[model samples]
Target: MKKTLLILIFLSCIVMANNLPELGDYSSSKISENEEIFIGRQILFQVNQSDSIIRDIEISDYLDLLGKRLINASTDPAKKIEFFIVNDSSINAFAMLGGVIGVHSGLFLASNTESELASVISHEIAHINQKHISRFLAQQERASYQSTFLMAVALLLARSNPQLASTTMAGASAGSVQGALDFTRENEKEADRVGIQTLNNAGFDVRGARDFFTTLKKANQFSGGAAPAFLQTHPITSNRISDIEDRLKDYPYKQRLGNQTFHYVKGKLKALLGDKSNTKNILEENIKNKIYINEAGERFALAYIYLMDNEFTKSQEQIQWLFDNEQSNPMLSQLYINYLIKTNKVTEAKKLYIQNLNFFPI
Candidate 1:
């Protein structure tokens, strides 16, 4: 029965891929937009069922806000885009079918500024907008549903489990489908070109693209080993960074401040996902040494840790300090709300929720 089901799925995908439009007279072409969306949705359904996704509302909202800003600045503003945060700690982001983009939390931990994160996102968005994946598929005249299915599975496992991804790739070798999965150098260069333009249009610092790629190149050089998964997939070279730098010369120099939310989300991820004892120790050490430039962020992170540890009074104290300092951040407000609810102060939580709604109505 299972074998029969798999055969049916394969037949359906073959039909779908065949129905896709041809690449025109050009050597390269793309699947239809509708087909791309369909494939994306199928992959996304699998992704949703996996343990790799981060389902936090706050993190989701922040990523959506940042992603939408970049998407709005892209050449096609009307295109629907979906953003997801993968729980993996690997420094990677990937664009999938149907304008779906997945960002690993490690990407956030690796990025020094919001612009750095945005730069990567913009690049992925460029890939989707340029239909690079579809074009690659079009180039594979004998593209099969089996190959496509394995490609999606490989990508889903890439950041979360490289070993599994490698195993899947080896299995896919039965069909010689690996070549269908790689983006061409031309596609990479085009994405870089259009991505920086999108960053600039989005009012982010374009230097971010250069700086982020440069950092990755340097890290890859010093690792004394195989390239990281991100570099393995994205394949950064010295020329890529140089090209971005050259493009930077055309844009007016502008210094954009990093978003406060970026720091907050980073802290939250650390407290929530990092080693518990280690996270507590690090927060304590930072507090003791006064190490953070943004002390409120430190306190906010500590409060989250405290909440996780069930040190209710300590959590309240930290939250109160943030409120006292007039931090007024939505994240902090949510923390306060959570605290109130936890302490059985439902009335207070309700009142606060009403006040927050009044201040920032949807």
Candidate 2:
């Protein structure tokens, strides 16, 4: 029975390997674009089956918009990209095959501005644009099948049982795994270099990348525990920060203002992930202490919490304050419309929508 089971597994592996697109030319040390897309689709199918993805429409729409902005600025603007927000709270983002990008919810909580978050997206998109994953697979000449299978398995296991995957990888020859890590590190550096240019070209504050790394480093130090998954994968060093800074020196220094939508998304994520009471308390405390640079975000958080809690009266009051203060803020306008619809005030919602369309005829 054991022998038969083993044979079945082996045959299945062979079948899977055969179904994959032909490996890129070994002599050229490259995987063909079609093969890369096929591998990416397979990996994405596995990822979806793991049930680790967050399916919030608002968050998904925001990430897609942000990702496409960066992709548009990349060398390969025409490449199709898909973005997902993972349910995990660990501060991490990764790019998989076929222009797929995953962002952890904790990353939203950790980021201070839209540009900070965009920096991470830009980095992941750069990895995809550069074909780092496919290149890495192409480099595994001897155990390509086993390595590819293990990689997919590792990704599926990462969210649920990372230790198991780590142990499995540790069983491999140290030299081989270490060489892969070294290559990944080199990829990280190249992604950073390319990502910074993409961020700048997309009209985001370039300093956001450096600022985010600095913040992550500080958080890692003060936590007195394991580094966040982002650092574990991206490996932030002082030299890395310095390299980003040096690149920044080439451009004229300009501070880009934070968008209202950035804070709105952050608040919405916090409300969705955190307990209502705790979120409310935290937002109140931040408002009381003036912790945030913009007081508007605190109000937005309260509004979002109220909206989630079905406290339409409170939600409307908070959103109204935001609209009164920032008349041009589209996010606030949308939220208010949502509130009106929820309260069965369709007439009001329709009138507001028409007014907005007239004012901003895109």
Candidate 3:
């Protein structure tokens, strides 16, 4: 009986050992808090500096809520995730290893609904939750074991070969930088699986993940060779979409998000990018489609477009609506001042400018 018990115990130990997460896998292990904080700050700096067209508080706040909901479902629910929208007009979103995820403002513009944004956010969140970034960093550290020695040798070589030191530093820095880390094809596949799982658990439409990738594939084809920055880093391939779709097949039921706000935001973004002369054509289509909630954003967009077209009278009519509203944007105030000055409304413009200056400085 004692011998039989020992055999069972040994088998149990073997099973437990097999279950342990291997090195560089996205399991429950954690890096130091200081390291997380350090990386977080760097990501914030990068996000702020990166060029983006939509830097509005309203858009960002909406994203924060969605992000928080998704992150709450993750194993490491405590990790604070920051989301930023890049100004560039590209359908790309990426996560910087240290809990920073950036979605291009163009993504919002392109996305037909909020689920599309959720798809991008969920994928990025998976990258962070799985410690994919840190795992890549650890690998790079191992591969560049001779980096210190190479740096010293390069400095010596720089005397004879001026390019040596610069090249070495560039290579070493690229390896270390969180944003520059490129996942292996295997890691990417794992991220896709986990990302879909996250989207499903968050009650978001997992099919949006598939659809978004399809859109990306189309965009990439159009780009020929010059893919957007997001695509440049987080590559989109045919297999990626197929693989995500396969995983989503297990969850057959589609998730529905009935919020009208997404249409409003997208319509606003369209107006911001579309032509002022054709505003009536575009807005009429939206109205015909019964997109009344988006009317405010479209109006605001037309107003900005008018300012750009130098249509002062039409612009004033648009601004009048903005002024009558309780919510005011300081930047809009500055723009109004410009419109006032341009149209030679000197006295009224001066008063508006002074009020804005006292309340909100440029």
Top TM-score hit: 1
Clashing pairs in 2: none
Worst 10 residues of 1 by lDDT: 1-10
TM-scores, one per candidate: 0.85, 0.82, 0.61
lDDT (C-alpha) at residue 222 in model 3 = 80
Q: Write the per-residue lDDT of candidate 2 for residues 1-362, one digit (tens) a residue.
A: 02232223333444566675544445445556765666667656655544456776767877888888889999889999887777666677877655677788888888988888999989988888888866666666544443464453344334222333355445533224433432266787899999999999999998888888877877688768777777766666677777888998987878776677777877777777757898898887897788885678778879878887799988888888887887476667777888888889999999999998887564
lDDT of 1 by residue, 144-225 (tens): 5544544443444443334335544464432444443446678788999999999999999998887787667666676676
lDDT of 3 by residue, 84-194 (tens): 765546566666545777666668876655677787788778888887765654444332223222221222222112222234335442223323334556767877788
Q: Rank the candidates by lDDT, best first.
A: 1, 2, 3
What C-alpha lDDT, on a 0 to 100 scale, does residue 81 get in candidate 1?
87
lDDT of each: 0.74, 0.71, 0.59
RMSD of each: 5.2, 5.6, 15.3
lDDT of 3: 0.59
TM-score of 2: 0.82
